[model samples]
Target: MNRTLYSGLWWLALPAVLGRLWWRGRKEPGYREHWGERLALGGPAEGQATIVLHAVSVGETRAAEPVVDALLKAYPDCRILLTHMTPTGRATGRQLFAHHGERVVQAYLPYDTGSMTRRFLRRHRPRAVILMETEVWPNLLHACARMDVPVVLANARLSERSLRRGQKAGAVMQEAARAFTLVAAQTELDAARIRSLGASNVEVTGSVKFDVTPPASALEKGDWLRSHIRAGGPERPVFLCASTREGEEVLILDAWQRLADKPAGSLLLLVPRHPQRFDEVADLVTARGMRLARRSQLDLDHAIDGADVLLGDSMGEMFAYYAACDCAYIGGSLLPLGGQNLIEACALGKPVLVGEHTFNFLDATIEAVGDGAALRVKDADALANEAARLLRDHAARMEMGARALAFARRHRGATLRTVELLQRVIR
Candidate 1:
């Protein structure tokens, strides 16, 4: 369907959207509090030219960090209007940009109906609208075009799978693609895909996520966490499953269990992608007869006492987990959920392992494996074997970690390149 039909359907689906929000709000109360903002009914921040940047959820919000910083530095006189679809993303935006004071204004991006889109644009009067990867809304793009608002797709990527899905929509996606004033893609493959989808102005800008340097404080905290987890004295290998999805946790646990003769005090850090699933994952670990420690329970003495597993249940602490671990199994790939960012682990100089499905970060994963920075296993059992072997062989693990750091360092200019593109948009 085209933009007209899509907009009509979106309008008709508002009630369903609200119902879904109500359902999600039962587990996460923050969703219940932001109804007005989702409808463009919130109060606006007066003064300063606004540039609206949309990051859909937690991952996108995190990836936007460097871009946000660059934007803040480049346009000190302007206010950054950050918009998000999920409560987690909103919370992250606030946490990340709180230091900037009123310079950063955050709210929900209205649903892609003409009325809501028009109302939001009218309210913000933004100089330009920048959308994080893969957030192509036909009505929103159409509305931006009509209002003469320049729209940019930053750190954009379109996998073969996503391209095929877009092909199903045909003209709707093509029209939406045309609305991008600039498409700063993560790779040349992404640039080609976006061009195939009818994006005219596209550039290969790598991934802005690569530009995010883990602060010294986070690294120090990670060192402390490592010591805290191994408080009983024997230094054990720490394995991290970062940003895991639903089915992957069970597979990960099974893999961890299958490892023969794991070192005494070997610790597995399991981090779920969603906050609501923290308790669920912790219970899963307990059900498997493993002692679980939650990161949220600040009492490290009590939390880690005789624990085999540490549940990374806190928000915005992914870097600490990456830093603390000796080797990491980047999650979401095992079950075809299109993988989380493996770059964070690599940046911290950790040996990385991933499952077969990493199409979400296909280029990065392929490059990492090719560079000997990571190992990709076929299934859960292979993952267990690889992790076990790497843990046992310190020299091999350190070699891989060195490669991982080199791989990360080589791809570090995307944020600056994207900011250059944004400068042209504002100009």
Candidate 2:
């Protein structure tokens, strides 16, 4: 519960952690060695203050992009280092911020061993470390605390599952959180969770994800997708199953077929969760005897009369895809993975129907439901009927879409408030 205990565990766990990292380095491509890390922290390159932001994966990395961009602009003399836990997130970060990367580098978070954490801290010598979301590694936090590097946790959300796990490891995790000089939580519940974890200087700062200024290209792409799929006819209902995990594709496909009799030209757009599974998903679609067309191959501005299902295989285009659909089923929630962000779809003005197992985005889901921006379904059958009815009534769909957009707009400034408090942690 104190610094001594926290650092002691980190010391005892160092050997096992380093051994695992060294062993796994042989199997993982992005896990290769980084000598530059030593240089990165030894001191600032020239006249820049060092700042490190650690985000576990793609979603968190994306959530921090605006903040990252804003920070780089605001602190012209500061060097920003972004660390990601997953290869996918690293790749996305590299692509998204290629220009800033020279000064703003991206790297894997060093394994949570005292030595590795010490070495990482010594190398990057981050003047400040801002941890994104909920990664509370003991050794690293202790190392930062020892070195007096201010650590701030920002845009944090605590779901029931994560909170329970944190409580089970309450002693260490609480100390780890306490090492931080500041904590910016996404909601009131999150602020309480952090405080209960022994995190002081905690502030409720909404969700930065709501502050995303989606690029201009999303509208262009959305319009193209809409006209192409509808074939220049009346506005059609497209039941988009977004970020679907493995095996959920079949249930979604089945649901689409179940609604076949309800409409004349309704369509389904299926987007699997990962880019690596694009080919696999395409194979599954054809194997299931469903006709399909790829988004890249079709001219979205025109019309495509041949496709029954449009596969959204492109990466970084979810905004456009969400915008193109009339009604959507946010995946992960339905097939039991606890769900993806329906708030994003709603932010783009699409009425979303989610499955009952949405533990991750419970608050956002509840708020959307209360606002009439989203609908909840138990399984494939209910999802099908809900889609059919919404699709049949254009006016109703439009109204729901308006409500969805309005809800998104209402939750806008969490990121700014989060950053304002976070600045205190650094100084």
Candidate 3:
């Protein structure tokens, strides 16, 4: 498909897209709150936007933190215009950049129609557009090209599956790929795959996630939370299963229940990836006859007693969860969904466990496992067994945790390289 056809299709699907947003809003009200911004109808008043960065969802929003901080520091006079596709991404951006005040403005990225994108670009009048990760919209790229606005794909990655899908998209995806002024890829493999789709000026700048430092406030919160988890009883090992997707929770819960050799009095911390599913996950835990306590309802000062499972129902506290746990199992990899980021857990010096289907983070997972920072299990049963073994062997856990921290520290400096690449296009 060509650009005109792409734009026409988007216009035709506009109503359905809006309807889907409304449907999703029944569970997550944030979707209903930002209706106008998605259409380029209303948002922050016109200002000199130095850069417009699009981070699609929570993971991308969090990954963009280091790069955002670097950009702000490198260009003191610059004001950033952050954009997102999901309400959670918008909320995460708001929480992460609340300290910047007016320096960082945010909005929902307008629909990828030629007119809407053009309106968005004209309204912001940013020096350049920087799309985080794998966001390459055909109409958006065409609009940027027509307007002579340079676009950069920062901290980019493309897995083999995604590359195959993009190739199937054919002309539209190729044209979009070619329109990028530069691409700061997370790995050489990513750079090569992006180049295969016709992107030029691709540079391997690594992942900006390595540059993100856990906030002191979050660490302190973790310590306090750990204390509470251990309060009123003997010290218990906490196993965190974070960023779990739809089907993974059931498997993880079943595996936990079937574990015959698990350490005594160990607590399971289950955090679903989507907020709308928190209650659903809680129900899953209760259905299994396990006691569940929600993080939202718990008092910070009180001890969490007799709860076999703690449901992490809060948002923007992933780092705190990482810091509080003895071992972490990064979710979304058990059945075929591309895995979630395990780097946060590693950066906190926690031993990590991941499933075999981590194609999305294949490079990072392989390197972490090779460096002894992470262990990859083939199935949920193995994940449970290995986590149990780690909990029982304190020395093995400590040794692995040390390697995890070292692996994290060795992979820094992506933010600086990405900022330097942005500098080239901003001028």
* RMSD to the hidden true structure, all candidates: 1.3, 3.8, 1.1
Clashing pairs in 3: none
lDDT tens string, model 1, 1-427?
7777877788889899899999999999988986888887885664579999999998899899999889989998788899999989989888888988888888888888878888888877789999999999887888889989999999998899999999998788999999889999999999999999999999999999888888787888898888787676777689888999999999989888978877667889999989999989999999999988888874535548488899999888889899888899999999878887899889989999999899999999999999999999999889878888888889999999999999999999999999998899884
lDDT of 2: 0.79
> Tens digit of lDDT per residue, candidate 2, span 1-427?
5446656776687667656656666645454455334223342343456789988787888788878877777677777888877666787787778877576777777766567688878766787888888778787888888999888888887887888888887577877877878888888998887788788888888888888866777788888788788775766678888989988887877766766566777788888877767787888888878788888778542345566788998777788898788788998887668887777888888988999988878888899999999999988888988988898888999999999999999999987787777666665
Supply every candidate's count of residue pairs whose N, Cα or C atoms clash at under 3 angstroms: 0, 7, 0
User: Where does model 3 exceed 4 Å of error?
Assistant: 300-303
Considering TM-score, which of the candidate structures 2 and 3 is the better prediction for this target? 3
Tell me the TM-score of each prediction against the true structure: 0.97, 0.88, 0.98
Q: Estimate, for each residue in 303-332, the C-alpha lDDT of model 3 and write its tens digit.
A: 476888999999999999998999999998
Q: lDDT for every model?
A: 0.89, 0.79, 0.92
Task: For model 3, state the Cα shift of residue 222 in Å.
Answer: 0.3
Q: Order of all candidates by TM-score, from best down to worst?
A: 3, 1, 2
TM-score of 2: 0.88
Q: Model 3: which ten-residue window has the lowest total lDDT? A: 297-306
